[model samples]
Target chain A: MSILVIAEHDNAELKGATLNTIAAAKAVGGDIDVLVAGSGCGAVAEAAAKVEGVSKVLVADNAAYEHQLAENVAKLVGDLGKNYSHIMAPATTTGKNMLPRAAALLDVQPISDIIAVESPDTFKRPIYAGNVIATVQSSDAIKVASVRTTAFDPVAAEGGSAAVETVDIVDDAAVSKFVGEELAESDRPELTAARVVISGGRGMQNGENFEMLNKVADKLGAAVGASRAAVDAGFVPNDMQVGQTGKIVAPDLYIAVGISGAIQHLAGMKDSKVIVAINKDEEAPIFSVADYGLVADLFDAVPELEAKL
Target chain B: MKVLVAVKRVVDYNVKVRPKADGSDVDIANVKMSINPFCEIAVEEAVRLKEKGVVSEIVAVSMGPKQCQEQIRTALALGADRGIQVETDAELQPLAVAKCLKAIVEKEEPQLVILGKQSIDGDNNQTGQMLAALTGMGQGTFASEVNVEEGSVKVTREIDGGLQTVELQLPAVVTTDLRLNEPRYASLPNIMKAKKKPLDVTNPDELGVDIAPRTKTLKVEPPAERQAGIKVGDVAELVEKLKNEAKVI
Candidate 1:
């Protein structure tokens, strides 16, 4: 089977999630083609060509796609994906924004986020905020799905030598225009790609209290996250939220501080290889999944832990 | 300008859903049901726009079994001027639902359409974008802030790295994110008034949209449980375990 895997990238570099999506595409057992659609994204296409298991890289470079607006990108994917057996993209904000629109253009029902590929036709995904896993089989002629990058191990980034081809498909649906963006400046790491992540919850109390977690995170070179409660309490921005409705992260080590271990929070981080929970309440549900549970006040233990590390 | 908002009825956010013993699907029988939280935010945004006089009328829509009308009523109480229910018993996938919404958009000719970014139950996160595709409208998904202008709307979207602002022409689609706004509670008098609001029921057949399942559920199962591990006595011991045993650090 031939699979079209959309590469998640900005104009300059490819995101790590695309490699994980390529891994998922490998699991589907197909000749994979990576689509890098953006303005001045030749570097991204070259990087995609180096990814292991990719057979070809298709670059659609144009001003209309510079911002990767869903209006233009979805039309591009829909028109080009007609030749493929399966179309997949990483379940990031960009993927979530455009893939379904493309699927509708194809008159196919697209699967949201698949964690496992049981087969080419059947896949497993989380429903009800990861409380239940559902195995669904598609009967449509073409299968469209979004891969949960955290569920799959990333493929090697620099091994393959695929041919890069430039496609001259320019879809400038003038319905939308790019204004601007405000990206968070961070020195540590991207939360989803980080090897280690330390997150805080409502017990962090205020935005300033995230400093404690930041100190610990800095020691470990880890990314800092927060629970939905913390974000809802206005202690942190919504981008820092780790929960069913927010970002899903799976690191080598996940540390939860002052979080009550709500099911929604667990849904995002339960896939971590090792979990550590630090809370004052021993009865917090977080203890149920933590590999190492520390029943202590985070205010004292976090500082002490940073010093010890 | 008129606004079209879509709402969904699903199991309450607090309810821990479990699959049936036969693995057919999630058992929602007799479970507490409520409007999906993100959809509530969409309703609130529409009400706020109406309160600002940028929107002349609000049309709330939902598609499901008969009971979905409760969610429509909730939207009315929140501030929608009218309600429409595309009643159906067939499984409503995102594509089919988008098609139905597209049909309504054609007839109503609303200037703006809003929906939750994702439903709590299915969590598909597809309807708004797909509707935009089918209707040939611009889309702004995961919107944290929305500003309706003279001929277009500016939306601040919550992307992976940070926030992005985009301007969409008139008759655009927007999906609500978590930080959009806090939804206000419906009072008793509003609930009574909502019961009298115009809620017209139409079927998928009437809209000329085919509601069919393109996928089949092979099974439903619980995620592998993570076994609880040992509790550390102090911070020093915890660090030692990580360096010596786990080696994660």
Candidate 2:
């Protein structure tokens, strides 16, 4: 059996999460071939070939794919569905958008966000916001899924000369939409892929106070995150929210400052490898789960933490 | 254009969820349930669209226990014109839920469908896209902004690198992101008005779909706890800890 990993990236550079997706594919113990589907993604295909445990990289470049339109992507992956035992991508907004469409078109159950591979065909994943873990065995002709990149280690570049094949592009005008552009904060680490994260809460008072968290994050080389209260109050964008309504992050080191631990906030970060809570309220719920708790005001604690780090 | 919004009831976001003694799932006893926040946003977006004269009707739908009626009523109170509850006691995998919703879409024949990108309880953001596929319609997931024009809709979406805006034909599925719109709370006056709104409760059997669970939970456990690390006093000292002790940098 062979595994097909759909490499996700902009036309310019590959994302590190693709490496972790490759790791999940590798765990299935199959020859891994990656598909880079987008316009002018030859560079990404070349990059994919250099990753360890990958045997081949296939590039399907066309203007129809500039946006990775879910319609066109499903058409392409569905066309290639007959050739592999498994088709996977990193579970991101993009992967989540397209893979299920492909899976539904294929009439298969998508093993969403597999945390582990018990075998080439059986996998483990979380359900109900990490409330339950289930081992799934796929009896479908082909298994398809999106990998939660946090669960696996990114394979280092082995610098190989693997073959790059250009596949026939599928043109489907069903996706007649174009996203004008996005106002992305280029300085921040992609929250989904960051290894270490520091998030703030409403206790910081307002948007400007996040500067302290940002400084400490920069020092630690961590991603800056925010609580739902902060996001709801307009301190930051909702994408930065760490809660039930936001992204689920499991970083190596998570430092939360000025945040009372709402169950929603704790739902998002409870899986971190190390947790440190800095809050003035000794009775804050965050202290119960925090390995290290500081009952000090963030106004005093943040700059000191930044200075000490 | 007509619109459909899907909602789900979950354990209140405030409750500290513990695993059942049998370790099958999170214990949900005594939890105050509410409309999934994102779904409320979706319903709000649709209702706002309706008020703007771009949309004609806002149909709210939910797939859960009979108790989901409260959530449906909540949607109506928030401004939905009507509600459809697909009665099912089974634990729904995203795929099965999509199937049921797709059946409703077939019957309602609305021009637009909206739902939260994912239900917080399941964290499976697949239903809308899956339903779109099952119904052979286009989809815009994680939409921060939505606008409807004659025969088509424009959406601004959140992606990893940045945002991207796309347009889709009507009879489309749009999932709400956190920034899509600020949902309005139901006023006491509106709450009274909603009591008179039409809510038709139906079974998954009536929807012509099986509610059998596609996936089963084997165990539920709190994630392993993290080890405590050092906290330093200043930047240079922290740098010392990183470069010398922890060596992560």
Instruction: Encode model 1's per-residue lDDT on A1-309: one tens digit a residue.
Output: 999999999999999999999998999998999999999999999999999999999999999999999999999999999999999999999999999999999999999899999999999999999999999999888999999999999999999999999999999989999999999999989998999999999999999999989998999999999999999999988898898988999999999999999999999999999999999999999999999999999999999999998
lDDT of 2 by residue, A142-261 (tens): 889789887898898766667999988675857457759766665767777687889999899999999998898888789998998898899987778876557778887788888898
Top candidate (DockQ): 1
lDDT tens digits, residue span B150-238, model 1: 99999999999899999999999999999999999999999999999999999999999998899988899888989999999999989
Clashing residue pairs in candidate 2 are: A179-B165, A307-B234, A307-B235, A308-B233, A308-B234, A308-B235, A308-B238, A309-B238, A309-B239, B111-B171
Task: Evaluate every candidate with DockQ and list the scores.
Answer: 0.92, 0.46
> Model 2, residue B7: what's the lDDT?
91
For lDDT, the strongest prediction is 1
Q: What TM-score would candidate 2 get against the native? A: 0.92
The CA lDDT at A205 in model 1 is: 95
**TM-score of each candidate?**
0.99, 0.92
Misplaced by over 4 Å in model 2 are B210-212, B227-249
